[model samples]
Target: MKFFTGFLLSMVFLALASCDSGDDAGVPDKGYRYFPLAVGHYQIYDIVEITYTLRDPDTARYELRVETPDSFLNADGDSTYVVYRSKRLPGEVAWTYLDTWSARRTPEELVVQEENIPYVKLRFPPYNGQVWNGNAYNTGERDDYQLDSLGQGQTRGAQHFDDCLTVLQHDNEDFIVFLDQRKEVYAADIGLVYKETTQLSYCTQPGCLAQQLVEQGVIYKQWLKEYGKAE
Candidate 1:
């Protein structure tokens, strides 16, 4: 009887130890994994863009697929990723290559350029209310980007993400006002799960005294459809 009781106690202790180990190996603490950039990491997102004009508002919806094909040496002799992006409008049979962009991720920030304009997409160790100059490299205009909030739970498609992030970029000039807002959600073991971007350009007419709606605005939303990692 004593031998059986000892065996039972040993089993219970082993079970408890296993449980603790499993918990430790589970999800990690809120680390700097908000954006997972790796070679061969690919993500497909459904994009919807809307543009406002004086005559009529135009809505153009499409699908944007991005994949990190390979890395190349930059001027600083560091490996920079070359992201290949493609776009396909709804009802289109084939996808068209949009452009090849370069991205570099350092311990501080993820720097990317779109249409020859460099911008800091994200900063490390994301925290609420953190502000940065997104348009630091832009000569035309400067924009202020801030982490509006964190831990915003969001669901996209069949997957659900918790503790998502929301960032906002806005700028105001003497006559023209621009705002480009974004909400991005990341998932463990995967890169960007969901993202949404809204851009607005408002200005007043020259003759009119008050601010007139010259342009309605534009909104772009993207969701993860499927992903395949390159080995």
Candidate 2:
């Protein structure tokens, strides 16, 4: 009888231990820090855009600054922050207003609207290989954005980030005809650190068909040059 009582106690202790392990393993990591947003926060990026056409390719270099200086409550009672975008030439001292956008964050996801098109930037508790439609809230065609990697280190130009993640927005290429690839990387506290987009159409002419000559489209790259909070 004593042996039986001791065995039962051992089983209970094992069950408790198992439950504790499960609780620890199931803790969710709400990765909201990767896209942190707040009033007075701003980021500056160096932009390089290359446009391809039947004529000579044109390249342009500029600096872009995005600032969040105000917020308002949307119809749904959720607070949405206003994003002000401005640009200046490489050596220019004055900035030209480009446009205004908006961004909202909830417990579940982050959404940003640009040119009246809303895009689901990232889903909460992001996990590697997770996929979702970036245009879920907009009228645009469906675009599957995937979190290709998470909690990884990334370096861009002279910047180094310890905790970062890469989102693969689109990647469809046919060297003979066309290419479309877009990706964005976000650091833990700095938001978007790097973005690259390439949309090109190859010439299908008999002579250039095999050469993979880019006939048209643009290649855009933006790298974070600095970030800070406005007074």
Candidate 3:
């Protein structure tokens, strides 16, 4: 059985390259510009997260706003952007700070470190079907990241984006056996648009495994609401 959960964009003209990974550090390619990692750039989103436990399932709807307000140097001496994230529930005018995320845009890759898990969010020169190991830092697991689409238009809610790209990330079979399945989607310039993860395990008898497998599963969906550039 499956439980249904109900869910929840923007424009700024910044001349950036689309599709085409340029040469190495010495090469002057604008391919990495698709993401536009600047101090004054920010995005707001409406998020819906549903969790299904063995006993009951619940849903949470909130508004998430992330902003690139500050920057600092990391241990490697690379300057990184400080992404401040805040959350607001429905019918509330105040936003509370949730956490802080870090993004480092190198010539080769755009690295995002969230919750202490570092992810190579994007490789230079965006192209269709380009695959990379996003979970290279984690020794216990490997996640496959691929550029599913590029140079196409995408629309969500009342906002529309041109020259957009979508990247897909998936877990390996070993991880899937325990997690069921996990998938993530990221849009060019806009960042993450949608994400869905399902976890289901089966056992012949109760208490047969360390953790009991339930008939219910959790699902989460996030969509872009509105976005703007900082002054």
Candidate 4:
């Protein structure tokens, strides 16, 4: 009888120890993850890629961002694009964005649309051209890039692109850093002002498509409650 009681007590102690060990192992390994921009929810998009060339005539500085399918000239004169964004929060950067590590990777060649990625679409005031595989003027190209540092532990993702504002110049005549203007919105009826240095728009081609709908009095305007400012 004494031996049996001792055996039972030992088993009970072992079981309790195993339960504690399991709990310690199950405290989820905390870390960041990457999700496409579409999964992010914000009233207004942080960046915008438009289909026009913004020129500073006074400073003789001009920046051209090709944002439509018409911008790329293929062997058959075709174009495609999509938006690859850096983060989901309006102004905050995420840890899982493709940045320094991606830039170090091998170059990627442009290809046709495939399953897996989401594309931004525009309806009203529609473009008189083909659909894009991703965002902006020229079709996707194989190149090298890094995420420009966003402040306070936020980092922009790296990308393959034609050009990004990698260098900062002191003179306003020398640079145009397209920035996200709104960190938060105060009121619905109030108007705002945006200086020349800062601008707000969607980041990728697909995001631009959504914005295009907003510009054209489409579904986005009725749904997303974000707005613009005075510049």
Which numbered prediction scores highest in lDDT against the true structure? 2
Clashes of each: 0, 0, 3, 23
Model 3 C-alpha lDDT per residue in residues 1-231, reported as the tens digit of each score: 122222100111222232333545346654665667778778878887777766777889999998999897779777799999999999999989999998998767888888888888789877789998888765537777888887777776666767666766764443322455555555556666555666655343545543445545666666777666889
Itemize residue pairs with steric clashes in candidate 3: 9-225, 20-125, 21-125
Q: What ranking of all candidate models by TM-score puts the best one first? A: 2, 3, 1, 4
Tell me how candidate 2 scores on lDDT.
0.93
For candidate 1, the per-residue lDDT at 156 reads 88
Which lDDT tens digits does candidate 1 get at residues 37-127?
6789888788777888766778777888898988977787666788899998888878799998877777677787776677887777778
Give Cα-based local distance difference scores for all models. 0.73, 0.93, 0.71, 0.25
lDDT of 3 at 98: 95
Task: Name the TM-score of candidate 3.
Answer: 0.73
TM-score, model 4 to reference:
0.20
Poorest stretch of ten by lDDT in candidate 4: 99-108
lDDT of 2 by residue, 141-200 (tens): 999999999999988978999999999999996677888899999999889999999999
Native-referenced Cα lDDT, model 1 = 0.73
Q: Estimate TM-scores for all models.
A: 0.71, 0.86, 0.73, 0.20
How far residue 84's Cα lies from its native spot in candidate 3, in Å, is 1.1
Winner by TM-score between candidate 2 and candidate 1 = 2
Query: Whose lDDT is higher: candidate 1's or candidate 2's?
Result: 2
